[model samples]
Target: MSASQAPSQPVPPSWKDLGKAASDILGKDYPIHGSTLEVKTHTPSGVTFRVFGLHDNKSSAITGDLEASWFDRKKGISLTQAWSTANVLRNQIELQNHLAKGLKFELISTLVPEKQAKNALLATTYKAPGLHIRNFVDVFKGPLLTSDAVVGRDGLLLGAETAYDAREKKVARYNLALGFYAPDYAVALHALGNLTTYSASYYHRVNADVEASARATYDSKASSNVNLEVGTKTYLDNAAFVKAKVNNSGILALGYAQALRPGVKATFGLALDTLKLSSGSADASAHKIGASLTFEA
Candidate 1:
Protein backbone atom coordinates (compact mmCIF):
# COMPACT_ATOMS: atom_id res chain seq x y z
CA MET A 1 0.00 0.00 0.00
CA SER A 2 1.06 3.59 -0.62
CA ALA A 3 2.40 5.61 2.31
CA SER A 4 -0.34 8.23 2.08
CA GLN A 5 -3.01 5.57 2.50
CA ALA A 6 -1.30 4.17 5.56
CA PRO A 7 -2.25 5.25 9.04
CA SER A 8 -0.86 8.69 9.82
CA GLN A 9 -0.83 8.10 13.58
CA PRO A 10 -0.65 4.57 14.87
CA VAL A 11 -0.12 3.07 18.30
CA PRO A 12 3.24 3.80 19.86
CA PRO A 13 5.78 1.24 18.72
CA SER A 14 7.92 -0.83 21.09
CA TRP A 15 10.95 0.95 22.54
CA LYS A 16 13.61 -1.37 21.15
CA ASP A 17 13.78 -0.93 17.38
CA LEU A 18 16.42 1.40 15.94
CA GLY A 19 17.02 0.93 12.26
CA LYS A 20 16.32 4.26 10.64
CA ALA A 21 18.78 6.65 9.02
CA ALA A 22 18.33 10.42 9.01
CA SER A 23 18.55 12.52 5.84
CA ASP A 24 18.33 16.15 6.97
CA ILE A 25 21.89 17.47 6.74
CA LEU A 26 21.91 20.83 8.56
CA GLY A 27 21.77 19.11 11.92
CA LYS A 28 18.68 19.98 14.00
CA ASP A 29 18.09 23.35 12.33
CA TYR A 30 16.28 22.05 9.26
CA PRO A 31 12.62 22.87 8.89
CA ILE A 32 9.93 20.23 9.44
CA HIS A 33 7.35 20.17 6.65
CA GLY A 34 3.67 19.63 7.30
CA SER A 35 1.09 17.90 5.10
CA THR A 36 2.92 19.28 2.06
CA LEU A 37 5.75 16.91 3.01
CA GLU A 38 9.52 16.50 2.42
CA VAL A 39 11.64 13.98 0.50
CA LYS A 40 15.23 12.78 0.59
CA THR A 41 17.52 10.57 -1.49
CA HIS A 42 20.88 8.94 -1.01
CA THR A 43 23.05 7.67 -3.83
CA PRO A 44 25.65 4.95 -3.91
CA SER A 45 28.24 7.60 -4.66
CA GLY A 46 28.03 8.97 -1.11
CA VAL A 47 25.59 11.77 -1.94
CA THR A 48 22.69 12.76 0.31
CA PHE A 49 20.03 15.04 -1.09
CA ARG A 50 16.72 16.29 0.26
CA VAL A 51 13.87 18.60 -0.77
CA PHE A 52 11.28 20.23 1.46
CA GLY A 53 7.86 21.69 0.65
CA LEU A 54 6.48 24.12 3.19
CA HIS A 55 2.80 24.83 3.12
CA ASP A 56 0.56 27.30 4.88
CA ASN A 57 -1.77 26.33 7.70
CA LYS A 58 -4.55 25.85 5.17
CA SER A 59 -2.32 23.86 2.85
CA SER A 60 -2.41 26.63 0.25
CA ALA A 61 0.58 28.15 -1.51
CA ILE A 62 3.84 26.26 -0.97
CA THR A 63 7.44 27.36 -0.56
CA GLY A 64 10.49 25.40 0.30
CA ASP A 65 14.13 24.44 -0.23
CA LEU A 66 16.54 21.91 -1.74
CA GLU A 67 19.67 20.61 -0.09
CA ALA A 68 22.42 18.27 -1.23
CA SER A 69 25.49 16.94 0.54
CA TRP A 70 28.29 14.71 -0.62
CA PHE A 71 31.49 13.39 0.83
CA ASP A 72 34.81 12.45 -0.72
CA ARG A 73 35.94 9.65 1.51
CA LYS A 74 39.42 9.33 0.07
CA LYS A 75 40.10 13.05 0.63
CA GLY A 76 38.31 13.09 3.98
CA ILE A 77 36.19 16.10 3.02
CA SER A 78 32.49 16.80 2.65
CA LEU A 79 30.48 19.62 1.10
CA THR A 80 26.89 20.74 1.42
CA GLN A 81 24.77 23.35 -0.33
CA ALA A 82 21.22 24.50 0.24
CA TRP A 83 19.02 26.88 -1.73
CA SER A 84 15.49 28.11 -1.30
CA THR A 85 13.28 30.54 -3.19
CA ALA A 86 11.54 31.61 -0.01
CA ASN A 87 14.32 34.17 0.61
CA VAL A 88 14.48 35.76 -2.87
CA LEU A 89 17.32 33.46 -3.96
CA ARG A 90 19.76 36.07 -2.59
CA ASN A 91 19.46 35.37 1.10
CA GLN A 92 18.82 31.67 0.48
CA ILE A 93 22.13 30.31 -0.73
CA GLU A 94 24.34 28.54 1.80
CA LEU A 95 27.49 26.51 1.32
CA GLN A 96 29.49 24.56 3.84
CA ASN A 97 32.59 22.40 3.66
CA HIS A 98 34.35 20.36 6.27
CA LEU A 99 37.49 18.27 6.68
CA ALA A 100 37.19 15.23 8.91
CA LYS A 101 40.69 14.49 10.14
CA GLY A 102 43.76 16.09 11.70
CA LEU A 103 44.23 19.81 11.05
CA LYS A 104 40.51 20.01 10.43
CA PHE A 105 38.91 23.06 8.88
CA GLU A 106 35.29 24.09 8.40
CA LEU A 107 34.09 26.97 6.26
CA ILE A 108 30.54 28.24 6.00
CA SER A 109 29.13 31.00 3.82
CA THR A 110 25.57 32.19 3.85
CA LEU A 111 23.85 35.04 2.06
CA VAL A 112 22.36 37.75 4.20
CA PRO A 113 20.49 41.02 3.83
CA GLU A 114 22.00 44.42 2.88
CA LYS A 115 23.68 43.09 -0.25
CA GLN A 116 26.22 41.29 1.92
CA ALA A 117 27.09 37.82 3.13
CA LYS A 118 29.19 36.33 5.92
CA ASN A 119 31.99 33.78 5.79
CA ALA A 120 33.53 32.07 8.77
CA LEU A 121 36.44 29.68 9.11
CA LEU A 122 37.28 27.34 11.93
CA ALA A 123 40.52 25.39 12.19
CA THR A 124 41.27 22.68 14.71
CA THR A 125 44.38 20.84 15.74
CA TYR A 126 44.30 17.56 17.59
CA LYS A 127 46.69 17.45 20.53
CA ALA A 128 47.31 13.72 20.27
CA PRO A 129 46.14 10.60 18.51
CA GLY A 130 43.10 8.96 20.14
CA LEU A 131 42.89 11.83 22.62
CA HIS A 132 39.85 14.08 23.10
CA ILE A 133 41.84 17.29 23.70
CA ARG A 134 41.83 19.69 20.76
CA ASN A 135 42.47 23.36 20.04
CA PHE A 136 40.37 25.57 17.78
CA VAL A 137 40.83 28.94 16.08
CA ASP A 138 37.91 30.78 14.56
CA VAL A 139 37.90 33.80 12.24
CA PHE A 140 35.17 35.66 10.46
CA LYS A 141 34.83 38.10 7.58
CA GLY A 142 32.12 40.07 5.76
CA PRO A 143 28.89 40.95 7.58
CA LEU A 144 28.79 40.89 11.39
CA LEU A 145 25.58 38.91 11.71
CA THR A 146 27.50 35.65 11.96
CA SER A 147 30.29 36.90 14.18
CA ASP A 148 31.12 39.08 17.13
CA ALA A 149 33.37 41.11 14.75
CA VAL A 150 36.09 41.38 17.39
CA VAL A 151 39.04 41.59 14.35
CA GLY A 152 42.72 41.69 14.28
CA ARG A 153 44.51 39.33 16.60
CA ASP A 154 42.07 40.42 19.28
CA GLY A 155 38.97 39.28 17.38
CA LEU A 156 40.00 35.67 17.03
CA LEU A 157 38.29 33.00 19.12
CA LEU A 158 40.41 30.39 20.82
CA GLY A 159 38.69 27.29 22.13
CA ALA A 160 39.38 23.73 23.19
CA GLU A 161 37.21 20.64 23.77
CA THR A 162 37.81 17.54 25.89
CA ALA A 163 35.62 14.68 27.00
CA TYR A 164 35.63 11.73 29.39
CA ASP A 165 34.33 8.37 28.23
CA ALA A 166 33.00 5.90 30.79
CA ARG A 167 31.35 3.24 28.67
CA GLU A 168 33.55 0.62 30.26
CA LYS A 169 32.21 1.53 33.68
CA LYS A 170 28.65 0.84 32.54
CA VAL A 171 27.54 4.02 34.22
CA ALA A 172 27.62 7.56 32.82
CA ARG A 173 29.91 9.86 30.91
CA TYR A 174 30.81 13.52 31.48
CA ASN A 175 32.08 16.30 29.25
CA LEU A 176 33.38 19.86 29.59
CA ALA A 177 33.61 22.61 26.99
CA LEU A 178 35.36 26.00 27.16
CA GLY A 179 35.57 28.91 24.77
CA PHE A 180 37.37 32.27 24.84
CA TYR A 181 36.48 34.87 22.25
CA ALA A 182 39.21 37.34 23.07
CA PRO A 183 42.08 38.75 21.06
CA ASP A 184 44.65 37.66 23.63
CA TYR A 185 44.97 35.20 26.43
CA ALA A 186 45.57 38.13 28.79
CA VAL A 187 42.20 39.59 27.85
CA ALA A 188 40.55 36.24 28.37
CA LEU A 189 42.18 36.00 31.79
CA HIS A 190 40.77 39.42 32.71
CA ALA A 191 37.28 38.09 31.78
CA LEU A 192 36.09 41.63 31.22
CA GLY A 193 36.66 42.45 27.56
CA ASN A 194 36.37 39.17 25.69
CA LEU A 195 33.17 37.16 25.78
CA THR A 196 33.19 33.55 26.89
CA THR A 197 30.82 30.60 27.17
CA TYR A 198 31.09 27.30 28.98
CA SER A 199 28.97 24.18 28.87
CA ALA A 200 28.95 20.69 30.39
CA SER A 201 26.90 17.58 29.89
CA TYR A 202 26.41 14.16 31.47
CA TYR A 203 25.10 11.19 29.51
CA HIS A 204 23.97 7.75 30.59
CA ARG A 205 23.01 4.73 28.58
CA VAL A 206 20.21 2.78 30.19
CA ASN A 207 20.34 -0.08 27.75
CA ALA A 208 20.59 -0.88 24.06
CA ASP A 209 17.36 0.97 23.42
CA VAL A 210 17.36 3.99 25.77
CA GLU A 211 19.65 6.80 26.86
CA ALA A 212 19.41 9.88 29.06
CA SER A 213 21.35 13.12 29.30
CA ALA A 214 21.51 16.38 31.16
CA ARG A 215 23.27 19.50 29.99
CA ALA A 216 24.06 22.94 31.36
CA THR A 217 25.16 26.11 29.63
CA TYR A 218 26.82 29.19 31.15
CA ASP A 219 27.43 32.43 29.33
CA SER A 220 29.84 34.94 30.78
CA LYS A 221 27.91 37.77 29.18
CA ALA A 222 24.66 36.63 30.78
CA SER A 223 25.46 35.24 34.19
CA SER A 224 22.09 35.90 35.71
CA ASN A 225 20.65 32.55 34.61
CA VAL A 226 22.44 29.40 33.59
CA ASN A 227 20.51 27.25 31.13
CA LEU A 228 19.92 23.58 31.85
CA GLU A 229 18.14 20.73 30.09
CA VAL A 230 17.40 17.07 30.75
CA GLY A 231 16.33 14.71 28.02
CA THR A 232 15.96 11.06 27.04
CA LYS A 233 15.79 9.10 23.80
CA THR A 234 14.31 5.67 23.22
CA TYR A 235 14.32 3.34 20.27
CA LEU A 236 10.99 1.65 19.74
CA ASP A 237 10.04 -1.59 18.07
CA ASN A 238 8.84 -1.57 14.45
CA ALA A 239 11.39 1.10 13.59
CA ALA A 240 10.07 3.87 15.78
CA PHE A 241 11.75 6.36 18.11
CA VAL A 242 10.74 8.78 20.83
CA LYS A 243 12.45 11.65 22.60
CA ALA A 244 11.32 13.70 25.55
CA LYS A 245 12.88 16.59 27.39
CA VAL A 246 12.36 19.32 29.95
CA ASN A 247 14.24 22.58 30.27
CA ASN A 248 14.96 24.97 33.13
CA SER A 249 11.94 27.08 32.24
CA GLY A 250 9.61 24.20 33.11
CA ILE A 251 8.85 23.57 29.47
CA LEU A 252 8.20 19.94 28.64
CA ALA A 253 8.32 18.47 25.15
CA LEU A 254 7.76 15.07 23.61
CA GLY A 255 8.44 13.86 20.10
CA TYR A 256 7.63 10.63 18.30
CA ALA A 257 9.30 9.52 15.08
CA GLN A 258 8.70 6.47 12.94
CA ALA A 259 9.49 4.98 9.59
CA LEU A 260 6.10 4.37 8.05
CA ARG A 261 7.35 2.58 4.98
CA PRO A 262 10.49 1.81 3.10
CA GLY A 263 12.39 5.04 2.53
CA VAL A 264 9.67 7.06 4.25
CA LYS A 265 9.54 8.54 7.75
CA ALA A 266 7.49 10.95 9.84
CA THR A 267 7.86 12.88 13.09
CA PHE A 268 5.37 14.46 15.46
CA GLY A 269 6.18 16.75 18.36
CA LEU A 270 4.26 18.50 21.11
CA ALA A 271 5.36 20.99 23.73
CA LEU A 272 3.66 22.16 26.91
CA ASP A 273 4.30 25.21 29.02
CA THR A 274 4.12 24.08 32.65
CA LEU A 275 4.05 27.64 33.91
CA LYS A 276 1.06 28.53 31.77
CA LEU A 277 -0.71 25.33 32.74
CA SER A 278 -0.10 26.06 36.40
CA SER A 279 -1.55 29.57 35.98
CA GLY A 280 -4.87 27.98 34.96
CA SER A 281 -5.06 29.80 31.65
CA ALA A 282 -7.00 27.85 29.05
CA ASP A 283 -5.07 29.43 26.14
CA ALA A 284 -4.38 26.81 23.47
CA SER A 285 -1.05 28.45 22.71
CA ALA A 286 0.33 26.89 25.86
CA HIS A 287 0.26 23.59 24.02
CA LYS A 288 1.65 23.11 20.52
CA ILE A 289 1.54 20.30 17.98
CA GLY A 290 3.76 19.80 14.96
CA ALA A 291 4.19 16.98 12.46
CA SER A 292 6.23 16.33 9.36
CA LEU A 293 6.58 13.55 6.80
CA THR A 294 9.52 12.66 4.61
CA PHE A 295 10.13 10.27 1.71
CA GLU A 296 13.52 8.94 0.76
CA ALA A 297 14.44 7.82 -2.69
Candidate 2:
Protein backbone atom coordinates (compact mmCIF):
# COMPACT_ATOMS: atom_id res chain seq x y z
CA MET A 1 0.00 0.00 0.00
CA SER A 2 1.09 3.59 -0.59
CA ALA A 3 2.46 5.58 2.37
CA SER A 4 -0.55 7.88 2.42
CA GLN A 5 -2.95 4.98 2.46
CA ALA A 6 -1.20 3.03 5.16
CA PRO A 7 -2.68 2.93 8.64
CA SER A 8 -1.22 5.33 11.16
CA GLN A 9 0.37 4.20 14.40
CA PRO A 10 -1.63 4.45 17.59
CA VAL A 11 -1.20 7.44 19.89
CA PRO A 12 0.59 7.10 23.19
CA PRO A 13 -1.06 7.44 26.58
CA SER A 14 -1.15 10.80 28.40
CA TRP A 15 1.88 12.13 30.25
CA LYS A 16 0.35 11.23 33.61
CA ASP A 17 0.34 7.61 32.53
CA LEU A 18 3.94 7.47 31.33
CA GLY A 19 5.10 5.30 34.22
CA LYS A 20 1.79 3.72 35.16
CA ALA A 21 2.90 0.24 34.26
CA ALA A 22 5.54 0.21 36.96
CA SER A 23 3.64 2.30 39.50
CA ASP A 24 0.56 0.12 39.38
CA ILE A 25 2.52 -3.00 40.15
CA LEU A 26 4.58 -1.34 42.87
CA GLY A 27 1.87 0.54 44.79
CA LYS A 28 -1.42 -1.37 44.58
CA ASP A 29 -3.05 -3.48 47.34
CA TYR A 30 -0.29 -3.07 49.88
CA PRO A 31 -1.83 -1.27 52.81
CA ILE A 32 0.58 -0.84 55.71
CA HIS A 33 -1.95 -1.13 58.50
CA GLY A 34 -5.59 -1.72 59.35
CA SER A 35 -8.20 -3.92 57.74
CA THR A 36 -10.29 -2.60 54.89
CA LEU A 37 -13.58 -3.85 53.52
CA GLU A 38 -15.01 -2.67 50.22
CA VAL A 39 -18.25 -3.49 48.46
CA LYS A 40 -19.47 -2.44 45.05
CA THR A 41 -22.76 -3.00 43.32
CA HIS A 42 -24.01 -1.97 39.93
CA THR A 43 -27.56 -1.72 38.67
CA PRO A 44 -28.96 -2.08 35.21
CA SER A 45 -29.94 1.59 35.20
CA GLY A 46 -26.39 2.94 34.88
CA VAL A 47 -25.92 3.42 38.61
CA THR A 48 -23.07 2.17 40.75
CA PHE A 49 -22.73 2.12 44.52
CA ARG A 50 -19.54 1.65 46.49
CA VAL A 51 -18.87 1.29 50.18
CA PHE A 52 -15.52 1.23 51.93
CA GLY A 53 -14.68 0.74 55.57
CA LEU A 54 -11.39 0.79 57.42
CA HIS A 55 -10.81 -0.57 60.90
CA ASP A 56 -7.60 -0.35 62.85
CA ASN A 57 -6.34 -0.43 66.41
CA LYS A 58 -6.84 3.30 66.75
CA SER A 59 -10.06 4.08 64.96
CA SER A 60 -12.66 2.96 62.46
CA ALA A 61 -14.40 4.85 59.69
CA ILE A 62 -16.67 4.16 56.78
CA THR A 63 -17.13 5.97 53.49
CA GLY A 64 -19.14 5.43 50.36
CA ASP A 65 -19.99 6.89 46.97
CA LEU A 66 -22.79 6.68 44.47
CA GLU A 67 -22.22 7.30 40.79
CA ALA A 68 -24.72 7.55 38.00
CA SER A 69 -24.16 8.12 34.35
CA TRP A 70 -26.22 9.03 31.30
CA PHE A 71 -24.79 8.59 27.86
CA ASP A 72 -25.85 9.31 24.30
CA ARG A 73 -24.01 6.64 22.39
CA LYS A 74 -24.82 8.07 18.97
CA LYS A 75 -23.89 11.63 19.88
CA GLY A 76 -20.80 10.76 21.98
CA ILE A 77 -21.95 12.73 24.99
CA SER A 78 -21.74 11.53 28.58
CA LEU A 79 -23.04 13.04 31.80
CA THR A 80 -22.06 11.75 35.20
CA GLN A 81 -22.97 12.50 38.80
CA ALA A 82 -21.00 11.22 41.78
CA TRP A 83 -21.62 11.75 45.48
CA SER A 84 -18.97 10.68 47.95
CA THR A 85 -18.84 10.75 51.71
CA ALA A 86 -15.35 10.49 53.08
CA ASN A 87 -13.56 12.96 55.36
CA VAL A 88 -15.83 15.50 53.81
CA LEU A 89 -19.12 15.00 52.05
CA ARG A 90 -18.95 16.14 48.47
CA ASN A 91 -20.67 15.77 45.12
CA GLN A 92 -19.30 16.07 41.62
CA ILE A 93 -21.05 16.52 38.30
CA GLU A 94 -19.23 16.05 35.02
CA LEU A 95 -20.05 16.29 31.36
CA GLN A 96 -17.94 15.01 28.44
CA ASN A 97 -18.40 15.15 24.74
CA HIS A 98 -16.39 14.77 21.61
CA LEU A 99 -15.99 18.06 19.80
CA ALA A 100 -14.30 16.72 16.70
CA LYS A 101 -12.83 13.54 15.38
CA GLY A 102 -9.70 13.75 17.52
CA LEU A 103 -10.70 16.29 20.16
CA LYS A 104 -12.84 15.97 23.31
CA PHE A 105 -14.10 18.36 25.97
CA GLU A 106 -14.89 17.80 29.65
CA LEU A 107 -16.27 19.98 32.42
CA ILE A 108 -16.46 19.05 36.07
CA SER A 109 -17.89 20.87 39.07
CA THR A 110 -17.58 19.88 42.70
CA LEU A 111 -19.87 20.79 45.59
CA VAL A 112 -18.97 20.56 49.24
CA PRO A 113 -20.90 20.65 52.50
CA GLU A 114 -21.41 24.41 52.84
CA LYS A 115 -20.37 25.51 49.36
CA GLN A 116 -22.83 25.10 46.50
CA ALA A 117 -20.00 25.09 44.00
CA LYS A 118 -16.61 24.56 45.54
CA ASN A 119 -14.61 24.29 42.36
CA ALA A 120 -14.92 23.75 38.66
CA LEU A 121 -12.35 22.36 36.22
CA LEU A 122 -12.39 22.40 32.46
CA ALA A 123 -10.35 19.90 30.45
CA THR A 124 -9.80 19.06 26.85
CA THR A 125 -7.97 16.19 25.19
CA TYR A 126 -6.80 15.59 21.69
CA LYS A 127 -5.33 12.44 20.20
CA ALA A 128 -3.93 11.98 16.74
CA PRO A 129 -1.94 9.27 15.03
CA GLY A 130 1.12 9.37 17.30
CA LEU A 131 0.44 12.35 19.53
CA HIS A 132 -1.72 13.14 22.54
CA ILE A 133 -2.42 16.40 24.33
CA ARG A 134 -4.39 17.36 27.42
CA ASN A 135 -5.15 20.73 28.99
CA PHE A 136 -6.87 21.53 32.26
CA VAL A 137 -7.91 24.75 33.99
CA ASP A 138 -9.39 25.33 37.39
CA VAL A 139 -11.92 28.04 36.71
CA PHE A 140 -13.12 28.38 40.29
CA LYS A 141 -10.03 28.96 42.42
CA GLY A 142 -6.89 30.76 41.28
CA PRO A 143 -7.61 29.76 37.71
CA LEU A 144 -4.53 27.53 37.56
CA LEU A 145 -3.83 26.08 34.16
CA THR A 146 -1.99 22.87 33.22
CA SER A 147 -1.06 21.20 29.98
CA ASP A 148 0.49 17.86 28.98
CA ALA A 149 1.58 16.45 25.69
CA VAL A 150 3.05 13.15 24.55
CA VAL A 151 4.36 11.91 21.26
CA GLY A 152 5.26 8.37 20.38
CA ARG A 153 6.46 6.51 17.34
CA ASP A 154 7.78 2.96 17.05
CA GLY A 155 7.58 2.34 20.80
CA LEU A 156 9.61 5.41 21.84
CA LEU A 157 7.79 8.15 23.73
CA LEU A 158 8.55 11.67 24.94
CA GLY A 159 6.29 13.73 27.13
CA ALA A 160 6.20 16.95 29.11
CA GLU A 161 3.78 18.56 31.53
CA THR A 162 3.58 22.01 33.06
CA ALA A 163 1.33 24.00 35.33
CA TYR A 164 0.88 27.78 35.36
CA ASP A 165 -0.42 29.99 38.12
CA ALA A 166 -2.57 32.39 36.17
CA ARG A 167 -3.31 34.55 39.18
CA GLU A 168 0.33 34.87 40.16
CA LYS A 169 1.48 35.23 36.59
CA LYS A 170 4.23 32.67 36.91
CA VAL A 171 4.98 29.09 36.06
CA ALA A 172 4.17 26.79 38.93
CA ARG A 173 5.84 23.49 38.00
CA TYR A 174 7.08 21.47 35.08
CA ASN A 175 8.09 17.86 34.44
CA LEU A 176 9.75 16.02 31.60
CA ALA A 177 9.79 12.31 30.85
CA LEU A 178 11.19 9.89 28.33
CA GLY A 179 9.89 6.37 28.00
CA PHE A 180 9.72 3.28 25.91
CA TYR A 181 6.68 1.04 25.86
CA ALA A 182 6.54 -2.41 24.37
CA PRO A 183 4.26 -5.39 24.50
CA ASP A 184 6.17 -7.09 27.28
CA TYR A 185 8.24 -4.41 28.93
CA ALA A 186 8.20 -0.66 29.65
CA VAL A 187 10.67 1.84 31.07
CA ALA A 188 10.43 5.49 32.00
CA LEU A 189 12.79 8.22 33.21
CA HIS A 190 11.33 11.32 34.76
CA ALA A 191 12.65 14.67 35.94
CA LEU A 192 10.12 16.07 38.39
CA GLY A 193 9.67 18.76 41.03
CA ASN A 194 11.23 21.40 38.82
CA LEU A 195 14.19 19.09 38.20
CA THR A 196 14.88 18.73 41.89
CA THR A 197 14.11 15.04 41.81
CA TYR A 198 14.79 12.37 39.24
CA SER A 199 13.09 8.99 39.07
CA ALA A 200 13.36 5.92 36.92
CA SER A 201 11.07 2.92 36.68
CA TYR A 202 11.03 -0.31 34.77
CA TYR A 203 8.41 -3.01 34.36
CA HIS A 204 8.71 -6.35 32.67
CA ARG A 205 6.30 -9.21 32.24
CA VAL A 206 8.56 -12.21 32.44
CA ASN A 207 5.93 -14.68 31.41
CA ALA A 208 2.22 -15.24 31.47
CA ASP A 209 2.14 -15.49 35.25
CA VAL A 210 5.01 -13.35 36.50
CA GLU A 211 5.80 -9.63 36.45
CA ALA A 212 8.63 -7.59 37.94
CA SER A 213 9.09 -3.90 38.53
CA ALA A 214 11.77 -1.62 39.94
CA ARG A 215 11.83 2.05 40.82
CA ALA A 216 14.51 4.45 42.02
CA THR A 217 14.52 8.08 42.94
CA TYR A 218 17.27 10.61 43.59
CA ASP A 219 16.89 14.05 45.09
CA SER A 220 19.38 16.57 43.79
CA LYS A 221 18.78 18.79 46.81
CA ALA A 222 19.80 16.11 49.29
CA SER A 223 23.27 14.72 50.03
CA SER A 224 23.59 11.17 48.81
CA ASN A 225 19.85 10.72 49.16
CA VAL A 226 18.77 7.97 46.81
CA ASN A 227 16.02 5.42 47.30
CA LEU A 228 15.53 2.20 45.37
CA GLU A 229 12.90 -0.49 45.50
CA VAL A 230 12.27 -3.68 43.59
CA GLY A 231 9.08 -5.69 43.51
CA THR A 232 7.76 -8.81 41.88
CA LYS A 233 4.34 -10.39 41.45
CA THR A 234 3.74 -14.02 40.68
CA TYR A 235 0.47 -15.78 40.07
CA LEU A 236 0.34 -19.11 41.83
CA ASP A 237 -2.74 -20.13 39.92
CA ASN A 238 -5.74 -18.68 38.23
CA ALA A 239 -7.23 -17.65 41.59
CA ALA A 240 -4.24 -16.66 43.69
CA PHE A 241 -1.30 -14.29 43.41
CA VAL A 242 1.59 -13.18 45.62
CA LYS A 243 3.78 -10.09 45.66
CA ALA A 244 7.02 -9.22 47.41
CA LYS A 245 9.07 -6.05 47.53
CA VAL A 246 12.13 -4.73 49.32
CA ASN A 247 13.70 -1.33 49.59
CA ASN A 248 17.24 -0.09 50.23
CA SER A 249 16.18 1.04 53.70
CA GLY A 250 15.99 -2.59 54.82
CA ILE A 251 12.20 -2.82 54.68
CA LEU A 252 10.52 -5.83 53.18
CA ALA A 253 6.87 -6.19 52.24
CA LEU A 254 4.89 -9.19 51.12
CA GLY A 255 1.31 -9.49 49.96
CA TYR A 256 -0.95 -12.37 49.02
CA ALA A 257 -4.33 -12.19 47.37
CA GLN A 258 -6.82 -14.94 46.66
CA ALA A 259 -10.13 -15.00 44.90
CA LEU A 260 -12.59 -16.42 47.39
CA ARG A 261 -15.46 -16.54 44.99
CA PRO A 262 -16.57 -15.21 41.64
CA GLY A 263 -17.07 -11.74 43.01
CA VAL A 264 -15.24 -11.81 46.27
CA LYS A 265 -11.51 -11.45 46.95
CA ALA A 266 -9.26 -11.22 49.99
CA THR A 267 -5.79 -9.74 50.41
CA PHE A 268 -3.28 -9.89 53.23
CA GLY A 269 -0.09 -7.87 53.59
CA LEU A 270 2.85 -7.81 55.97
CA ALA A 271 5.88 -5.55 56.28
CA LEU A 272 8.98 -6.03 58.36
CA ASP A 273 12.06 -4.02 59.24
CA THR A 274 14.85 -6.23 58.03
CA LEU A 275 17.51 -4.18 59.76
CA LYS A 276 15.96 -4.82 63.15
CA LEU A 277 15.50 -8.45 62.24
CA SER A 278 19.23 -8.79 61.57
CA SER A 279 20.05 -7.23 64.95
CA GLY A 280 17.69 -9.72 66.70
CA SER A 281 15.97 -6.79 68.36
CA ALA A 282 12.82 -6.66 66.33
CA ASP A 283 9.55 -6.64 68.22
CA ALA A 284 5.96 -7.08 67.16
CA SER A 285 5.61 -3.31 66.92
CA ALA A 286 8.36 -3.22 64.35
CA HIS A 287 6.25 -5.23 61.94
CA LYS A 288 3.01 -4.17 60.31
CA ILE A 289 0.18 -6.34 59.06
CA GLY A 290 -2.90 -5.53 57.04
CA ALA A 291 -5.74 -7.27 55.26
CA SER A 292 -8.58 -6.33 52.97
CA LEU A 293 -11.76 -7.85 51.65
CA THR A 294 -13.50 -6.87 48.43
CA PHE A 295 -16.92 -7.77 47.08
CA GLU A 296 -18.30 -6.78 43.72
CA ALA A 297 -21.48 -7.48 41.84
Instruction: Judging by TM-score against the true structure, name the best candidate.
Output: 2
Task: Quote each prediction's TM-score.
Answer: 0.55, 0.89
lDDT of candidate 1 over 1-297, digit per residue (tens): 896785433221111110001101101212232344788889999988888877654455678888888877776667878777655222122222233333444555566544555444443432222232222222342221111111112222233222222333231222222222221111121121122655544445567887666656678776867788777778898688788878888877777888988888887877777878755565665666667788988
Candidate number with greatest lDDT: 2
C-alpha positional error of residue 36 in candidate 2 after TM-score superposition, expressed in Å:
1.8
Residue runs of model 2 more than 4 Å from their true location after superposition: 56-89, 93-97, 114-117, 278-280
The TM-score between candidate 1 and the true structure equals 0.55
Q: Write the per-residue lDDT of candidate 2 for residues 205-265, one digit (tens) a residue.
A: 9999999999999989885778999999999999999999999998899999999999999
lDDT score for residue 15 of model 1: 12
**Candidate 2, residue 234: how far the Cα is off, in Å:** 0.4
Provide the overall lDDT of each model, using Cα atoms, as 2-decimal numbers: 0.50, 0.84
